[model samples]
Target: MMPQQDQPANPAPLGLMAFGMTTVLLSLINLNIVDATLEKSFVLTMALFFGGIVQLIAGGIAFKRGDTFAATAFSAYGSFWESLAFYWVLNSEPIGLAPAASARATASFMIMWGIFTFLMWILTFKHSWNLVWIFGTLWMTFFLLAAHALRGTEILLRAAGYFGLVCGILAIWASFCILFFEHTGVELPGASRPL
Candidate 1:
């Protein structure tokens, strides 16, 4: 009797993860560019609202695929940011005596997100150090800095911006890796390497 041959597993889930990461990176890049170049409230609002929506959707799909930590973290924070941006868009005015009230609100949100990221880091500790975790950690750091920046701190804002840039670059690189694998069946050398 001939030996049974093993079958290859579906690659769709991995592809989805890659796609989600890519979208996130692109959105981050867009936001960063707006911050660095235009510095307009409108641009920031649009980026946050639209990007948050994308992240929410991607996170939802990831959740369905059993990436519980990623799903919850992304979906929760994405929704929070988007909703906050929408609130500001509709209100168009700061609340009372908060010293850039909008900034304070943002800071609070970031602090919450940072806490979630820490949880995610703990959950994923057993996993290998890869682009996903690296970006995840960077995302958490951005939130931490954002929290500080919202307290009228310029240094924190600068630090957050630098970290955001790094996150964006990693996201873009991860996206290209997926695109490459999808099209040409080639793999990168690290965590995203082909099985």
Candidate 2:
């Protein structure tokens, strides 16, 4: 009989941290807690490198580990960050000079992401509470941003920022839980239990 190949290390935690950190930074800007200039100077760089490239690498590792859910989540969000960074970079001065997306177009973009996240959230029910909550707030954040764009309402944007912050924090906690389990074989709360 042929020997089985060793399994790859879990990649979800790395991807989760990447996503969480970038989301938190962006959420801070959305909340007006951080200087708006940082979005272009700092956040976009993080989105392109850490959230985008690193998460893409994690997605590839997850695919190797035969984790379809992690693979899809990491890949999709990685692309999202990359595309968002590119949107700003291409539109800003001394770059490609591409016209900025209109509010309608931005709303449409966010709505599409919201729909995608909602579908993914439905799938998270079979996973764990951490994932369920992470995806749940994530979809809400996307929808709230879409609503803000569509209605030009500051309240909706603020609401989205709050939801996004929660989602990012949850994701970071979940990442630590996974890392803790992998290191010490102890499952953190809500990490191994499904609803």
Candidate 3:
């Protein structure tokens, strides 16, 4: 019989924290609680480094651990962040693409992501209430942003920002729970089981 390899450390917490922190920052700007002046580079920087690269690393770890869901979530979202950062750069200032994309085009991009998030949320039912909530709010945030993009509605943007903030907080809580469990060997109340 072949011997089993040692179990890898869980990377979910790291991935979640990356997602959470990035989401929170962007959401704050959307909510207008923070200056949008930093939106041009700072948020994109976080998206590329922490949300994109870090999550990709976590996804790789999850893949090594044979966690299909985590691998998919991390890798896909990581790519989303990287692509989004590039998109903003391409749409802005010096490098702005010729015949720039229409608002409908941007709305389409957000809608596609919303659909993806919705699919992921469906799978979260088999995971935990925490995941369900996180994915649920996330999909809503995407859709709201898409609506705002399409209609140029400030209210929709604010709503998206609020939902995104909730999603970020939930992700952070899940990360903390997992980290706490890893350290204490006691599962916390939030992400212990499927609900």
**Which candidate do you rate higher for TM-score, 1 or 3?**
3
Candidate 2 collision pairs: none
**Model 3 residue 102 lDDT score:** 86
Model 3, 1-195: lDDT tens digits are 221468677889999999999999999999999999788878989998999999999999999989999999999999989988878788788888844668898889989999999999999999988899999999999999999988998999999999999999999999998888767877777675575
What ranges in model 3 sit over 4 Å off? 1-5, 97-100
TM-score of each prediction: 0.62, 0.95, 0.93
Rank by lDDT, highest first: 2, 3, 1
lDDT of each: 0.53, 0.92, 0.91
Native-to-model Cα distance after best TM-score fit, residue 24 in candidate 1, in Å: 9.2
RMSD for all candidates, in order, please.
6.9, 2.9, 3.0
Give per-residue lDDT, candidate 1, residue 59. 72
* Candidates sorted on TM-score, descending: 2, 3, 1
Candidate 1 residue pairs that clash:
none
- Which whole-number lDDT from 0 to 100 does residue 139 have in model 1? 61
Worst 10 residues of 3 by lDDT: 1-10
- Candidate 2 residue lDDT tens string, 1-195: 221468767888899999999999999989999999998889989999999999999999989888899999999999999999999899988796789788999999999999999999999989989999999999999999999998988899999999999999999999999888877888889796575
In model 1, state the lDDT of residue 75: 73
